[model samples]
Target: MGCVLSGLKWPRTPSKDHVTPEPLLPTLGLTPQQQQLLIETWELLKQDIAKVGVIVFIRLFETHPECKDVFFLFHDVDDLKLSKELRAHGLRVLSVVEKSVARIENVTRLEKFLFELGRSHYRYKAPPRYYQYVGIEFLSAIRPILKEKWTPEVEEVWKVLFTYICAVMKAGYQEEENKHNEKTPTMKRLEKSQATAM
Candidate 1:
């Protein structure tokens, strides 16, 4: 026992890099059953994330052609050139929602995250109302995939959750709009002063 103890080495500190990821979001507004179903559904979809992403953007374009003009990435994307850019954009958007869902219990985190999303989206000048189509099209994309498991209850659950998500995002959009308006004349003056200095 004494010899074995002498040979052993133990560290006095835990590794800093071993921080645990934050636990998945709480059920929040949904019931326990609803939360379980959603988690299961997301597990299923996440397995085929790339494919679902492809389906989402494709459906978005099919349903709302005008949404294409809102993003600069879509400007050069003709019908024949859909897959590459659309797939990348689709994955990015879905990833954000996945993170939001993971932190569902943390409404503050979700709102802050999406608020930044909306604020940045202001650069695209995308109308706030247009984001509804994404929820619609994403549901349409996932419906057939979920098939037999996709019940009316599932639809209602997603509807409630996404509606909340969109509302938070819209608040973010409004914040950016307010700042933009506040900067109106100051932005012009700065530009004019820069021209004079040059």
Candidate 2:
């Protein structure tokens, strides 16, 4: 099932790398059953959200060391579990997931929120490619808490949910990047030169 969904590639705009069009937001693609599963599973995960958050980031840093550099606060930290900063940051991320789950039924609102989040991430120098990693780590962290409740169907729904979130966020990041580039002096000069040449 994962392999089948794998073929549903992230939509990309022609202008830049993985920048999707803002107006045409992607669908959540989750059925009623899937949404219910997410809502139910989320209740169980929420009981240990704080612990799960720490575990998620630690596993992320372990699997992808480059991600650690993104968090300047965690740079000098020797132990992630003991780091207060890590705990706080992990909780903040879990909060975003909480918000997303709450807005699952409202696609437009969810997209707008995630889009703004992506724009913020762009400012933080976090790339869209890394967004998927969070989803991966999130699934890993929740598995133990969910235990028997975790099934292939539940996993598929979570994967679909993350895929949609990451896609919208990537679009938002690209839009912000485009705005920043347009404001650059080099871009202005290049545009002027091109106009004069024409």
Best by TM-score: 2
**Per-prediction TM-score:** 0.76, 0.82
The lDDT of each candidate is: 0.76, 0.88
RMSD list, candidates in order = 17.0, 8.3
- Over 1-198, each residue of candidate 2 has an lDDT whose tens digit, in order, gives 556655877443454555444456688977778888889999989989889999999999999998877887887789889988899999999999999999998878898999999999999999999999999999998888898998999889999999998999998998889888868798888889999999
Worst 10 residues of 1 by lDDT: 19-28
Q: Per-residue lDDT tens digits of candidate 1, residues 1-198?
A: 555655666434657765544323332487778777777788878877878887877777777777778866776666623558778888898897698778666667877787788787787697678788888888988898898989998888778778776776777777778777778787979988999999
Show where candidate 2 strays beyond 4 Å.
1-24, 186-198
Error of 2 at 9 (Å): 21
Q: Which stretches of candidate 1 lie over 4 Å from their true place?
A: 1-28, 80-82, 191-198
> What's the C-alpha lDDT at position 24 in model 1?
36
